[model samples]
Target: MADTALPGTRVKVPFAGQAVDGFVLARIAESEHPGRLQPLRRAVSAEPVLAPEIAELVGDVAARYAGTRSDVLRLAVPARHATTEKADSVPAGTVPPPDLAAWSTYEGSAALAGLAAGESPRLVWTVGPGDDGIELLADAAVATASAGRGALVCLPDVRDVARLDKALVQRLGKGRHVVLTADAGPAKRYAAFLAVARGAVRIVIGTRAAAFAPVHDLGLVAIWDDGDDLYAEPRAPYPHTREVLLLRAQRAETAVLLAAHARSVEAEYLVRSAWATSVALPRDEVRRRAAVSVTGDSDLDLARDPRARSSRLPKEVFEVLREALTVGPVLVQTPRAGYATRLACESCRTPASCPACHGPLRIGAAQAPPSCTWCGTVATGWSCPECGGRGLRAPVLGDRRTAEELGRAFPSIPVQTSSAERIIDRVRARPGIVVATPGAEPPAEGGYAAVVLLDTWLLLARSDLRAEEEALRRWLNAAALVGSTADRPGRVVAVGDPARGSLQALVRWDPAGFAQREIAERQEAHLPPASRVATLTGPAELLEGALAVLQLPAGAEVLGPVEVGDGSEEQRYVVRVPRTAGAQLSAALVALQASRSARKEQHLRVDVDPVTLG
Candidate 1:
């Protein structure tokens, strides 16, 4: 059994008089131990499910995120399915040559040409509005497959996966590619994994976890919307999909394409550092593709509609919606999802909070009692803590409330809502209003005539560091669904202060410019993308102990160990360092964790380059 256990094969061995399962990483010629080692109890399977490249990637990811190798492996490789593993492998299908017509529309067709020639070319692709990115990705994948090399594409959600899967089938016949997502049951996912490992499939597409798909002789790794928080793993070590793919591209010399409607600061940094080339449409082409207008772009416009600042639906927005409705369905993108996610005193305008947990209170629907968002406690007879006012007012309007208001304003037109609870995949292109929260907006058949962005202040008012950046990304994503052309351009109306940078970026349809400005601002402030940051969260004593033992790298600065949560004992400490010293910072944190583990002390939660600082 020991002789049959090859690298990547699973085996069972005796450890401290107990049987333990582990993977055979390598077969060493000699052991350093003077005493004879115990023989393996049995080989679980002779199949090398974990490939050598994937094993190395797992180790690199663990080290980069300051996590244990086992933790990273758990995410890289799925749980074994015996029945699926025992199944026979399917034969590989022939892939047709890819047509490069679609690549001609963009300025960076060379990147696609490079993939066809089997050369590694890195690109930060900003997909333009009114474009089908799924089709383009399918073309890239086919180009790689035609060269007899595997391709992997990672999307943000299952809907995207389904869309891309259909496009792949249309481009490259059936059985040429496999879909790998957690939504697919364990058996099906394992079967797909086995197919890839056995070289039965050359193309793999899925969400999040698919970034680690072990495709043999990989030639390209592409990720769409790299800035979406969904790409950040919630598990320990919290490895981000973009970072993981970048590492893989660097190590394997594989082609990488990070495509999105809006650019993330990290992606912008890559372009600035000459690590990746920027692929985007010309400014004039962008304007022709996206027709965006902010409510108060000039003082004369503000003077013409004085109510624009105070009203949720300005006259300009109403005019756009009313005109667009005559042609096709109109999309309304709201910031929140519930009826009233925030309540304030009607008289004093003071925020309402729950007396029990001091959490903000919210109303689920009309005539519904206010409840605590954090503790879920119903707030009966709630009063403002600052003022003695008993009346409550909804300061922040959600999608449901916006839909109700729109329904009243346009009684003849039907109003539908799409949110987390009820997601609409597609809507007919008719004269109706579709109210949807960001990311939940369904694509309308023939495309929406116009998109109205409401409650823009709510999106920008968050205490998060990426509030503006995230708002622009969501706005671009929603606006991209509208169809546009040189003759009949799509209309997009945003109700917000036009002077703000994010709103200005939307008006000009310049996400790349916005990202450049954002990166410069962050660099000046010593924030992420320009520098590295790590957060330590746990009890105060444990966090302090961890910090005390940490060997600080040069130029590293330790910020406050501030109290977190609602007067809880938990505390958080932030460590900032230059981007060049990121590895050193991770190493120090890993050593600190090791020391705590050796002493059997409470471990601190350490996250390097966390997505959110709040």
Candidate 2:
């Protein structure tokens, strides 16, 4: 036996009823029953998959999320493909970073300049919504690389990664950087991982998993659009990418840059606590780059009309689109992607449901029969149960339907649709209608001539705690696509009440101020960003037992053992604690999990700062 075997030693061992690849912990130099120990099957790799820093990160994440160490490790170090094991090493190269000095003249650039000089500057940067953010992010990475240190930039998804990848390759040249994302498949992804792990690449850009990428000589960690839901890991433990980077910064004492079009309450908390500095452009500069406006039905005189509120494109929006189309393409942002998401009865104004299954009905086309969204059953002869109405109405419209409507409205022009399954990256400068759902809007070459944000009420009426905050983010992201005054004068018209804070924020183009107000509201309401919250899901008896032993901090507020599922058989409970005791709460939960494991109790699902309590 090797006396000096240590952690991160790759080995094969028994796992889940088979011999699977694993890693070594340490040597049992003085084990009480050394003879009884099973021999390590074999070594899997010649090098460690995770560096010491990443390994420590896995431990911290596991403890914080109350998740099993194995699960966190699984995400940290994905499975390697055999084909990449023999890949050749990458040669070094360098390119001068773009002029970031001009950015230093902006409000928050000094801290960033300090970071570029190899000082650890933790700052939250707010940039107006647009593709301009791509340049800002690439510049930050370039500065880090120029400082002779490796940098990791994490975006929300593969699409964002591709966009930033182009910008980086343009700024930093080719061999100096690598991108890590699952979309590239196992072999290519693993190849990139190995390249970074072997110190062949000094800059790495990727999605959520890249937050843990073992870049050599790490100096900076940057995350773009930190508020995107895609950054919220879906697997057990559900560690958010933003928090992971923050922890990495604290542990490694590296510079941290969090850039977003709209501020997240968590980011606001960091700034308020003085843990991170705030970076923003001057108000005039922002307005010069982005011209945003807020409009409502009243502005279009539709509020006086009894049936005008339900019209997808009110007269005002139609007029705006008509005028904007002459200049360039117009973008219409819808909430969902379908023909008709929600159907209703024309006579009674009642929701239409399928007779066969009594499920909510939706229409795939204007002439299509009502179909149940749940059971997929077509209701050819459906009647409104309340009013016996035969005619159907669309209460909520989706992108496909909006595109179809706009197509008919402007028969001479083209209408394009972008969404989750079918995403278009860029649209050439032309006179047309681009109908897209949130986050799926394609970038216009010269930027959209104008934008109409529809159904603001519907977007904000979600049960999630960050619903309003996220609505504004999506709106800003779409609006920011409008051209600057130099390229094409931009204009935006939102279809909602202008008095609302989110809409007002959009009008004023002030996300930071909006975030500050949101923080205050959350504090008053005792919601996240103000106070820590944890949700527990399990069998009722098991949860009861677990809560009985949970040593919560002082003044902890327990919410409910809310009933879930179909009127039977399942429930989930929520517990809240003061934000100051968040760490203590996590510690207590970790201890409880260990206790449960020791007694072999049934597992319980634990999530902190969950996006939704319902």
lDDT of each: 0.88, 0.83
lDDT for residue 23 in candidate 1, whole number 0-100: 85
Encode model 1's per-residue lDDT on 185-287: one tens digit a residue. 9999989988998888879999988888889899999999999999999998899999999899889999999999899999998999999999988788877
lDDT tens digits, residue span 307-385, model 2: 4466656667777889888888889999989989999999988989878778899988778877899999988888878
Model 2 misses residue 299 by how many Å?
Answer: 7.5
Number of the top TM-score candidate: 1
TM-score, one value per model: 0.95, 0.93
Query: Cα miss at 612, model 2 (Å)?
Result: 2.0
